[model samples]
Target: MSQQRIGDRYELVEELSHGGMGDVWRGYDAVLDRPVAVKLVRQQSVTSPELAEEFAKRFRREARITARIQHSGVPQVYDAVLDDSLERLFLVMELVDGVPLSAYLRNGRPLPVAWAAAVVAQVATVLSYAHDVPAIHRDLKPGNILVARDGTVKVLDFGIAAILRTDVTKLTATGTPIGTYQYMAPEQVRGGRITPQTDLYALGCVLHELLSGRLLFTADSEYAIMFQHVNAAPQPLRELRADVPPPLEELVLHLLRKAPEARPADVQEVYERLRPYLPPPGSEPAPNEAGPDGVPDPTGLFRNPYAPRSRARAEQRPPAGEGQPAAQPVPAPVPGALREEIKEAYAHADALLDEERFAQAAEVLGGVVERAARALGPESRQVLELRTHRAAIQLLGGDYRSALPEFDSLADAYGRTAGPGSEQARACRAQAARCRAELGQVTEALAALEDLLALVRSVDGDVSEEAVELRRDIGMLLLAQGRTIESRHILEPLYDDLCVVFGPDDELTVEIAEALALIRLGLDASSP
Candidate 1:
């Protein structure tokens, strides 16, 4: 059989593992020329077409949110792919060279106290960063944790649980909960709200199993295991292993508390509690203090925090920009096949936009923009238009970080191709400013908009649509910044212009009038 390809870029090499949600493959990225782990999730039994669409939206949203987490412990998400039918989903991620924590549990032998503590400490640090992103790992378990060759603990599937839980009963058609029974928090078993504490409870279960060589709770059936988690009291680690430290046992109990509120306040607190067990900075392990056979020492990080790579390893590292796919040189004239591909890409992107799939639309356009730029010259109108459309779609999808730079680049390109005073240039500049405002850089955004508003007025006059929109944006930004007087100064005149140009009953005119009325009420009330 021919090799399976995803998004026409990732080529599956072999199956790695299979789980309830999907099958993971060892894949190769044809574009980047690197190894990637591709998770193929097949949803074949959707009850209705409407439900499938909702699932696709939630899956894409959660995947984007998960990618926002910047940390070494969580594998970087490279891409998310959904087929036209929205049934076969693919998540391409950084392929980790590591062994799952479950491998160490094969012989039912407990790990050394320091080794187990080191692993959990690393996981806790990663969780602290993830929770700050507010991306909770609702299904954290041993199988999802990997110990890399360098002993770094990588946590997998950051947003997969939330994606599955979007409409669990309806999507799964089973009315079953969405976490591992043995490691699930009591609230999860009870169908209560999940929070960061839910992950902490799972962490406690992992630590207990690592130290005791057995699960925290066990039964023949999944329901029985869940029952033990919800209502049964846990046996203290000390009772199972006399070698367990008193404080460590106490910490485990605290994390596995029945109530979410009763667990440690957050992973940060848990990290602090485990610090006593971690190797101190600049310290070296004793001659006999080695970890399990074939397993790297987890304490190496604490012993030499942020150490530089060895000279040999550094020599093997690729220089910046090496190994990345380079754009093909453009021929004297663009090929017919390439032009056809560009046209098809644009048509597909427009259709996706009609369906309100903003992110996917942006992706579809992005897939062709690079090739179009190389073939048609970077400054060609076609390339510029494609970039502008993709940036607008990104802005609509709430990806201001990605949109801001694209808009800025498009503004400069439009000015070079069309003129500094061109409407297209001014519009791109305004969009960039709006992106800045969305990103909370209000002061800079206001300054840019004000300057652009002046430019718009000079070129198109004060009542032009561009000038009117800029004025409205500036007024609202000032109002948000608590500068009511300044906001009124800008909006009061613009409201009159809207009424004169489009009538008082026009949607834009009425919206401005309502805003002015609210500002008046505030000023009148504050006079006392």
Candidate 2:
């Protein structure tokens, strides 16, 4: 155990630090030719036979979970193993060379709001990714975040990681606490169920400290900090850092909500609401993450709040002649019992949304959508689609932008329901690209059209009329983007095919003919 290599490859160079549960070391991985920080469980946390088994399982769990997650701002895990004597366990992780965020914040000058937000955004993305796989970092603080020399920020510690795998030994157990109390969520402080939102609350504390160059919350004792977390609100950020953006001020406050439900539903919403205010996605936004009362609505604009939504967006009817599903005729003698049930479910789901009870609505509407899709058939425009207020609710609940992916998915779904050439199919494809473009995913927007072409080719065999029309749409976008060569190649063949298939008088034939004529005019006009 004295200055030695453990589990073969890692050569322990020096003891780095120690805490209640383990000792940490600076080590060399000769095989990987890199320095790594190895954490070894203290004999105390691993002494019991049953605890040893649990400790091994948990250590491996952290390693396995972290190994799958790749983020530039996270320390990567290399290996996890038990020492031969079984008195110790260790994990090898990337060695980070940087100051802890707390050290960086200690500078006389407070961090720029944008840089602080950027660091938080990076961590939020990491948390979001972990949350997606149902993992929670469980421990988050300024000290746990490494600020590298190159301005890169890396979030460390999954030692107390909780993966929602459901076998139940997941929650970090101590009678009254786990993570640093000042950053603990009310639920975690209260010893209740913890969700990804708990990690978000801890981030809020970190953000507050960095921007103000001070602690957001503090108590003389751990018990006092835990008590404060359960029933307190950190002083508003702007109060400490007067120059803090008004919107981010709102975000920090919202995150510090004593009630978890009052906070942004996930780390994503927290970041996305603030992301728009930042430039380049990694920078800060102008005017900050603000709201209607002029506070930050990092609940984000789409996330509905806890209060009853007094006004809902009036449903936008599908464009005329688009996917405008024809209203079903009330069949004569329809049973009151079945009609009542359908009316009941739809109303209840809407009620849940109006009350900002999204999870409840998801539970209710999920059943409604599932049964409706099954009964109506997946292709039915009238099926259990995420149309109506549900999409808005999903966005409001911060499940990410609900409207974009739904449009793409439903566009694909509609392609199957109505033939690809049908107006419904085209409208869905167009809507998805519009969202992609609006969301700043230009390359992804282009891919949406490519998908449309794929659907067209699949539905309309090669040499078919629909395939030629799909090519025209693709050509139009390419031409607009200055990709005239590829555009012309696709359009010229289409025009040649249409000239024979429908003659010059046909609408599609004339369209392609006009496009080709314009292309030739441009080429000829540009000639010397």
Candidate 3:
């Protein structure tokens, strides 16, 4: 199919997947220049025009409610658009990079108990916020759950079920349930009311499958599955896997209770029950608890809740400041074989980086940096260069907290070895400021950038590329903080310098000019 543009902003690139309700596309937001997931709702075959109009209204309302979920686990809903025809509806959402939980059930191999608990606990946390919105998922299954590379769980298609289940009939024309039958609750199968408890039942199914490596019920047909959901007792998890924790199995049974009220009071209670199995804060998973191959550890979030990226080396270095000791002398040169090994490591890292495998590339360099640092003192030019490269890779991978301190240390090391005025030291300091900016330390970032800019100007003058970039950064940072007058002052001088250095037609010159123009307009509007 030809690529289609929705709402004049989201341009479909390729179809990612299709479900009963709609087709999800890997898309791009033209205005923002960012990737987005565009879900196009299938035009349902309604009997009358009024029904179609009502469906459109419900779709918009549901999309808006889903956007209010306000949890990191939910892919942010950016926009909902319906054409005047009422046949075409689209939802633009944050493009999540993750592997669906379905991918984790490799060859029916059971997941680690802690891994399963971690996934469920995170899901419960998301459900708590969603239930507070009183937004029942109606369909919670492994297919809709994503384990991000950073070990965070993301729940997808939050309100799509409600939008599609506008009618009372539980089964579609194909004789399949509205949601996946394997994970449907008894009420959902019987066309009864759906409450937050419905989601708990589904979560129970997911947990059971995660631990047992099999569905709660398997049958010859979708009808049989639905019948089992409404009538049959779920097989105890311990029956399928002896290693299953008794309390966890009990909690699953509690969630799978035939009646909604028979289940745990709320998602909070379910989370509390699962908490005993969750990794404690700042704890690391045991070697035996490693998850399936190529799958990120879902337990990492619980293990180090809100923790910063870990430094490759265990020891912390002293902070860079006045009266710091002089740089250590460089060690003897490395043997030819080791030098070649270092070259190969760099080559491999670069190849990984070219493929956008940033985390792996960072890891590859990290493995070699320490060995190289030991051979050539930590302050040696070669070691500093290696550290700088790995730090840049970390920053690109969005590990700002990890990159920040490395940049700070590199700056100090470079200052001591190559002199404070050296280009290397200034660049490292500037990078540290950028990391601070990314980490939301705006005040600290601005202070650091301003100080570095002064130092850059003292060495290279106002028109130097480094000085020009620093001025632009400071101006943009001020503009972002709503300090329009201050931003204008910084940009006004920078614009003049840009025009003199690179001419008015240069891209940098035009950018600064445009920013100045916008600032002037805002200032004029706010004037008394």
Candidate 4:
């Protein structure tokens, strides 16, 4: 329904996919001017009014809990709404672009050893972080894992199992489990206590299937599969596939252990066991390493280590000169000899920036800055502010290459003149961090924001808007990097503060709310 708008903001654009739980529509947030995914829980699926109420509570809980996961593989949730009629429930989330793992299984061919291992390792890493949140992904299957074009393995439906946990229970209303039959853990079949090991068992089953091109336990009936999961032994991997390594085979069997306690201790241990199969750092894989789809090797994170390496640094001097200048430099003459008032030009540029005409704003600021620099000195406060404004505009306009150096220079200048701890210096550093994020230097951006946030908190106190804004930026950046849990921890509280200080109508308040919603839906919409 192109004309249908949910929550007075999100206009449904196209139906992305549908499942037993609900329909997922690609939507546009009219207020924020961005794309979002709207998941509408089918009212008819509720079965009864009592179940409907419970479903709402569980949906809210799972959404909030999902937001707590800090891994980059988890999508960011944007918003959750329960219609007043309680007939329909909606989750607005970041829209992820990727192919489902189910696509790989279509050919029924066992994947390459490294490829299979790479996918599992990435899932395990995500689980390692998720397990720490103590949230069990009761259902983990090929359909729930997406391989982004960038070789990023994003785990979907993180808390959705819980959201629709009653879906199965309502069907039988007796004792059918919530998870899929093939991937269900033995403990899950027995209705035993769920724990982190439950997820590890599912991971093992997924890994086995990926390596063997078959389910671990297959039978004519679902009950038989459940029985096999609880009481039957899995077939040996090496026996089924000649290429499967002993260590890997052993690791899979260990993960498939019948007892929760018997399974590998945790996801961390599973990740380590898979480590040997991973490509070494800075490695160039053989022709076979790449998938038939030509998907970039997901193992590159292990092989090349995407972390930025330290560059040798030479001693640097102050950007504002040896000392702070007491006076402004004289204005430079334009080719046409056109003279414009600096304040008027700044006002016009600011208006443009507010309207989101970032390039135009930066251009205007640039000329003013040049004239201001020549009229005043290069180190003049007015010139410095103008440069800062231009850098920020460029950054907002998505020109990271230009913004990065400008912010970097501004930071040094502010540091030299106002002291590193000064408000202006910290603000410039914060802008630089934003530039890093825009440039795809996620780790560097996070480190920079963390440092700046700490400095701002110490200097301006915790309640200051500067400190609060820094926290918001840090949360958004973490979400960008797929650290949902950490972002949730920061944004949840920051949102509350913003609401109290600036009210729910404030722009920052709405933004934080949107961010939390994105984290819930396993999406990252934090790009220019």
Candidate 5:
């Protein structure tokens, strides 16, 4: 309801979708002044007081687990709140503006080879990260995957599926099957032990349908489809779609293998197999390539891949004498008359910044920076300060593409003027790394962070707040990259120090504690 508010902060704007677990609503966060998706738990799932309490705990656990997945392909979980009455459950998440994959699956023919492969490859990358969280998505269907306007494929309902797993297991009074029948793995139908392989099998079902433009196993009744999943052999992709490449077709069949172990070893292997079908960097996209609902080309990343992070790929920092950008000599100063003008411009920019006009503040500061560089000196601390403020404003404005190079240049400038290990240089490096992370250059971000962390520890010592914060950041970055063991190695000690320095009530301390708990959960799940 448009007039309804959940948790006294999120006002429901419009219902997005409704399923067994809950109704997803496009909501407005009044306090934050931003759009959010609010998933309200299905009232029927918590009809009794005892069941309501149980569901609340399950909801919180799953919400936290889902939030731990830091991939861009997974929507960020913002908050989970239960109403004072305990009659309602709400999960606030990033509002994804996209078209469900099911929209394209409705077409009567196969998608372009590159297009189909691109989607599957992205999904595989996401699965690799999800599996590391050790959270198996019980349901993987076209409906749960969305192709965002930017061509990023987002997997939805990771936690929601887990929440509803038990409820769906009870045989219905009518003997009707639950879940999307066409996408159900044979193991799922038989109520076998669900694992990461279960998701792979469902992915295979989805991939088959994408290539054939039809269900993997067609039947008139839901029960018939379930039976076919357990017994029927799928026809080869080429038989239905002659244009499907042999290698691609073979990969699809491998993913659809009847036994869990019979499938590819992991999503990584699935991605590698799909790589041959993906367009090479700088290659042209398929004709008429706009996806369903005017979504951007998903193949763009494959066609023009981000430059590899040299250091991270090598797993070693460059020697002191190598790989550094050449330094430039500072420019000579301009006339003294311009000094007052530059100061005035900076004042004006500061006023704009205080008003939250970040872009305009950056623009105002940019002129001051140029004039100050000329009137004072390019290497002057004043000039560097002006440039730094402008770069920070660009970042705050969400102009990441513009901010990244600025921060990089600022890092070099600060290093030259203030020494590489100076606080100013370290701050610039940290900001640049954050920019890289925001731009989806995770490897570069991690490498930059690690280098900065080492420098910070040498200058500030391990227990210094700066070093502690950098450690926390580095650990989170590692977690985001699915390097769970490395993340734990960094986070555990950082959390202990944070508790000692800032006390257990500190936000960063609490966050690191939660992260460590998630890491333990993954470890516990994998143990015998």
Candidate 6:
């Protein structure tokens, strides 16, 4: 859609960017003689009288919303209006100068910690005010951050993201999953509630990346990257970049914890934590000192997270953050063509899955499963085993009945590939048994488990902590089948094992104790 002139005052310049919903353009205000950004709403994000009306209101109100924010970091809103046919709407905002933070980071150099902290402080200050005004950015990332020539950092995109909290859901029919996934907090990813800490967590990742010049987590694809953010423990920044101070290392990792409960409650805390890191004014060297290699820390500013780095926890430093000289960077293009080959198979396999040709997806993924199994060798816990996990998801969709037998075969294969006693194999076996149980083949499920358990017991390999709970599975199944005597016998031994493995105060033992008490009470009170 052509940018419609706003109120006969602003002339749309040229399209700057496009998203799922709309196009953004630079515009000139005839009266004010200043440049402004106008975002025209896409027709697809609107439908029906009610939606159109709400879209119109939100579109017009964006100017008012951005106007309410009083901060140097936030862009000033000039106007929001509907165009000639009333089918199109646009927002006019201060045209921020300079490239986005995403482009800045792509220059392939570790950003100095002090510079990163300075930038983050501005963000936290911006967020603190916005949240206090009962507004949140919802989407905050390097892409939305604008860095000007004078080192001024400005945050863009407030109005549209603000309405996304409620208005995005109202457009459910045609809504694409909004926001960049890499920066999404765990709660935001799950569609659960979000709080101020969510933004702070993302800031932690940004800071880690700025200091280390490496992604905090990475995978073969974007979705895998998101999955890691949501599930995996981030490798500590200190481990990834030895120059990271131990205290700051622990702090960033703490902020990036999978649970929001682990982060600082608000931006005030972020600001306070970052304040000291900013080099005292005027003492800093020339800007060209900002080389791609990162500002040299002759004294090793963040050599460790514990050092007397911040006055707050200097006493806790492990001998004043002194550590061995920084570890060399991992040379890239890591060899081992076998892994790359499997990756290529899985990438094509995932593409087929997205194209909805499950049969083809299964075939490619099957090859991946086989090759990865061989490359990882027998009884390996290497992550390549997750290929089977991905393959199983497609199998569960419409092909459950046929998939059931394949699942059984895969379980046996996994038994050999991951070793029957290993967590990966046991997880596969349990999933297979679950499918059978769901199909009302409980007897088959029990028999399969018994066979797996006997085989596992015969193996002379490491038993995962999961093995401790397998006995409980057997006991629970027996108890449900009117085999009270046998169930109690199994439960008694499992109860003893739990006590030995997990002290009485442990969470798992508490669960086992409760189950055992129920059986004991049942036997004492009545024969049944």
The candidate maximizing lDDT is 3
lDDT per model vs. reference: 0.84, 0.65, 0.85, 0.78, 0.78, 0.64
**What digit string (tens of lDDT, one per residue) describes model 6 on residues 1-528?**
123467787767577988755688877665654557887766555557787777677766655767798997787877777775658777778887666777657765777666677677777778888788766676788877876644567887775664544434211223434556677777766666767777777888788877777767777866676667788888787776776667778778878988888787778877787767766633554463363432223212222323432321111211111233223323233238766765776676566556565654454555455555565543344333544545475555445554565555555555444444455555666666656666667796787666656655565321335455456677777877768788888777766766776677788778778877887788888964
Residue 369 of model 1: what lDDT? 85
Candidate 4, run of 10 with poorest lDDT: 312-321
The most accurate candidate by TM-score is 3
Pairwise lDDT winner, candidates 1 and 4: 1
Clashes of 6: 8
Q: How much does candidate 2 score in TM-score?
A: 0.50
Tens digit per residue, CA lDDT, model 3, 222-281: 888888998899999888889888998999999999999999999999999998899889
lDDT of 1 by residue, 1-528 (tens): 246889988878679999987899988776655568999875544668888988889889989988988999999999999988777888899999899998877789888788889999999999999999889999999999999887889999988877777444221135677878889998888778889999999999999999899999988977788888888899998888998889999999999999999999999999999999888889877654565687767887888888865432111222211243333334346688977877887887787677676765676688788998887888777788899989999998788988988888887776666665677877888898999999898997998898888777777899988888999999999998989999999999999888889999999999889999999999999997
Please tell me which model should have the higher TM-score, number 1 or number 5.
Answer: 1
Q: Per-residue alpha-carbon lDDT of model 2 for 1-528, expressed as tens digits?
A: 124888877778678777644677888664654568998755444557786677667667767887767776678888887776666678788888766666665554556665667678767877877787666777788767776644456787775434212222212434434566667787876566778788888988888876777777677977676777776657887777778878889998888887778889888789877775444522233565331231122222123323343442333434323443334433244246534655676687676567565644544544456555555455554442434335445445544344666655665555455544565656566555655555556575677567656666676764565456457767877777778778898898887777787788999888878888888888888899
Worst lDDT window (10 residues) for model 6? 312-321
Pairs in steric clash, model 6: 245-302, 245-304, 245-305, 246-304, 246-305, 247-305, 247-306, 306-317
Positional deviation of residue 493's Cα in model 2 after best superposition, in angstroms: 61
Off by over 4 Å in 2: 19-21, 43-47, 107-109, 161-176, 276-528
RMSD of each: 15.0, 24.6, 11.7, 18.1, 16.9, 29.1
| Candidates by lDDT, descending order | 3, 1, 5, 4, 2, 6
Q: What is residue 7's positional error in candidate 6, in angstroms?
A: 3.3
What is the TM-score of each predicted model, taking all chains together? 0.58, 0.50, 0.63, 0.58, 0.57, 0.51
C-alpha lDDT of residue 215 in model 5: 82
Cα RMSD for predicted model 6: 29.1
The superposed Cα distance between candidate 5 and the true structure at residue 187, in angstroms, equals 1.7
